[model samples]
Target: MIPYVREIQFEYGACDQVSPLIRRVVANNPGPFTYLGTGTYIIGKGEVAVIDPGPDMPDHLEALLAALEGETVTHILVTHHHTDHSPLARPLQEKTGAKIYGCAVGAKAGDSAVITEAGHDLDFSPDIDICGGGAVFEGPGWTLEAIATPGHTSNHICFALKEENALFSGDHIMGWSTTVVSPPDGDMTAYMDSLDKVKARGFDILWPTHGPPVRDVAPFIEAYIAHRRAREAQVLKALADGHGRIKDMIPTLYAEVDKRLWPAAARSVLGHMIDLVRRGIVVTDAPEPGLDSDYRLAG
Candidate 1:
């Protein structure tokens, strides 16, 4: 079974009306793709917003149009500039003439930008800029506050629906597997800080760009926090076990990680190692250029 095809239903707003906002328009991403993200529909009074238009596939775009047959799209909000999520921004904006909004325009390391496996780039640029934190858009009855959630990407942003008490989490907090923290673009410290920031706000629901919606925010945040700490601990252990380099630690520390995704995993480990070095938990001669870096537990 494909990851995004699964149907998820959530009650919209404070009303008893349940709306099926997310529907899988297209499946399969190029490269060693394990899952395709769900295209989200935010239905409002007279206007609508589509979040993370997945890829630029014709069928997917057509499906999106079909889904919003009788509706008017006021804005196309991108959670992040990732290919799987933001590639369709341009094409969708062209089709609907809606303003595209996101953190910024650029590609990040370990992202699908360089690799065209997932889908072709739509090369869309938003009419209005919402990059810096606190940029907001107010619709008829709904308003979206673009919260700067950097770490996953330098320009990554998440949308918060003030009226609904909900948040469009993007890849920051997913219902499925843990998000890949690939660095150069992705920073572990920033990611951890973003999580804490969201937790402080206390949202009621999380409408992630992928997988199912997170109904409970507190416990979910706690688990995610714990998971990262545990991974950091594992990294420390790997260093103590005489694993001098990332390559040496891969098989022993991240043995269960997918072979195809090892590169991404290694980047994440490197990010953690960087953090450990800053805290004196680990010592590195110098910042590793790539993934190969000699590291040892601090005395």
Candidate 2:
């Protein structure tokens, strides 16, 4: 089981210093997907770099600006173009003259793909594209290296803080719950590969945008990888046992999950189906493997 950090101590609209180089202000937008809301991080001291400016709430904007009263925001770094994570970036930039940096919008943006719980920020295009990873951004006393991790979204990126040995993980990995891999953009194969990639980096800690930091790095990541592999095995077994459609397998596969979240679970299952088909382990009749498509064991 993933060691989920369900409770965090912080008031809405208040900035709290979580580390020597990081101060976070949590946005007040909480929901089923967003644990306590978006934790917009300010890295460094004098000239700071903001990671994930969060939703465009007027109150949140005011609170964030208030927290950085005398400091200069040199770079506004986005993890992805999700509405909840990056909508406030442009507005913050307009106020601070900070350059926005992150991955480009997914090529499948505005397509017929199923919209996940958190929607896309179609209007967001980063001033600097750090999607391919290995791009470094530094301020007064901190340096952040962007690492591409696409699964939760095609363009998701994580920022590694060299000074703190921590990674600002967006939705790629969360401490509250598993990330929803909605597709046409979210890919299970890519997600698994990205998980392995992050694990190999061996960061000391992970500070996800929506939850508290993941302090036990290695074991936590191992659990995530194991959970996904186990889920795929269960999905394959369901297909072999005559559960061809995604909806048909949900009742048993996600028996512990709330009914309201079944839709998101179905999308994750579809991601696995697409990956299975690509691996020649499964076959589907639709032009692309999707939630409604019938999947069967490859002959």
Candidate 3:
């Protein structure tokens, strides 16, 4: 198991200070994917920085503005271009006159993958691509180092708070659930590499956007990587046993998973197959390996 953290105590549109410098305001939007909702983070005190402005709900925006009644929002930092994560950035920026900083506009993923909670927002263009240059953002009392962790999307970026030795891990590494790596934007190979990059950073805590903090950093990450490796092993085993298509492997591979999430699971499996095909461990019959592609082990 990945030691998933599912419990969180918070009210909708209420900004609660979870740490000395971090105040989180949960959006009213809730579902199977979003857990309680998108937790928009406010970092620092006087001149604050906001991470993951979340969905474009008017009430959520009002609550955010209310939370920073006296403070100046100098920077609005986004994690990725997912509709749940970055759609409010534009409206928030208009209200506070804060410069938006984070990943660039997202490239279109394949049409087959439907990101259930909120789809990608192609219109979300940041003022600064933090991945370029030094990738550092500083506020009154905090400094955030942007770590490019593309996998969930080609443009995903996680921010590390240097003052607290914590990372505001976006959708890259959630504490609640395993990240959805759908293609062609979601690359399993890049996702695995990013996991290694984060593990090497050795942060004390990870405050994911969707759920509560991950306190046990090292072991949790190890389990996460191990879980993926195990999934790969299972995929190979399935391929060896005559399960050559993603749809065929789904029932056994994700037997415990809810049927509703099977489509999402299929997309993830496709990501793995794409990686496997690239490494020459498997061969695909389709022009490009996709959800419907047939696969077999290399001779």
Candidate whose lDDT is highest? 2
Model 3 agreement with the true structure over 8-62: per-residue lDDT tens digits: 9999988999998899999988776677799999999989999999999999999
Residue 254 displacement in candidate 2 (angstroms)? 1.4
Question: How well does candidate 1 match the true structure in TM-score terms?
Answer: 0.84
Regions more than 4 Å wrong, model 1: 1-36, 106-124, 287-289
1 or 2, which is superior by TM-score?
2
Query: Stretches of candidate 2 above 4 Å error?
Result: none
**What is the TM-score of each predicted model, taking all chains together?**
0.84, 0.98, 0.97
Q: After superposition, how far is residue 200 of candidate 1 from its true place, in Å?
A: 0.8
Candidate 1 per-residue C-alpha lDDT over 1-299 given as tens digits, one digit per residue, 9 for 90 to 100 = 11222254432111112343333343234234324345454546446777787666676677677766788888888877667788777888888989888765555544552332333233545667677779877777777888988876767789888887888888788776567776667788889999999999999988776656688778888888888898888888777778778877777666776687666677778778777776778887764534666778888
- Pairs that collide in candidate 3 are none
- Arrange candidates, best lDDT first: 2, 3, 1
Candidate 2 structure, TM-score to reference: 0.98
Pairs of residues clashing in candidate 2: none
Would you give me the overall lDDT of model 1? 0.69
Better of 2 and 3 by lDDT: 2
The candidate with the higher lDDT, 1 or 2, is 2
Which 10 residues in a row give candidate 2 its minimum summed lDDT? 109-118
Q: Report the poorest 10 consecutive residues by lDDT, candidate 3.
A: 105-114
